[model samples]
Target: MKATILLFASARETVGAPSLTVELDENSTVGGLRSALARACPALIPLLPFLRIAIDSEYARNDQQIIPHDAELAVIPPVSGGSSLEIPAPP
Candidate 1:
């Protein structure tokens, strides 16, 4: 299966690309994608723990199945803000 992965903020910089196209096995899980990413981009290995993944624009869990033919996938790192709150502040 094939999917497009989008990187955000530091993840974009670390992976050295804004997005990439990848092929995976059918019914691949989010965790499987992370392993594939680490193989494709060594820089992503250490940071995987801090990253968040999305499937079709929604947050995804490690066990989540990737619908490569039906959805877009993204591997995003935690975004930082100047504010003290750990969660994203309202715009």
Candidate 2:
């Protein structure tokens, strides 16, 4: 199956492309895509470990299978969401 993966943030900067279309196995997983992506874009190998795979805007696990459908795939870079505020416990 062939799918197009969108890139964002650091991932976009790393590849220098907004998106990529690659052929993958029908039962490919997020981890598998990482491998194929590394081959397609050698520069991304280092970032693969840190990048997160999103299917339809939702985070996907490495072992999660890439469903054969019109799902939006995105390579999301680590985002710093700022430190959390302290919350006091109530009795």
lDDT values for all models:
0.77, 0.83
Candidate 2 residues 1-91, lDDT tens each?
A: 8889999777788779999888888889999988889988998877777789999989999999988568899998777576222221332
- Among the numbered candidates, top TM-score falls to 2
What are the clash counts of all predictions, listed in order?
0, 0
Candidate 1: deviation at residue 23, Å?
A: 2.3
Which candidate should be chosen as best, given lDDT against the real structure?
2
TM value for model 2: 0.84
Clashing pairs in 2: none
Clashing pairs in 1: none
**Candidate 1 weakest lDDT stretch, 10 residues:** 82-91
Encode model 1's per-residue lDDT on 1-91: one tens digit a residue: 7767888776787767899767778988998888888877887676778789989889999998886567877776665555421334334
Give the Cα error of residue 33 in candidate 1, in Å: 0.5
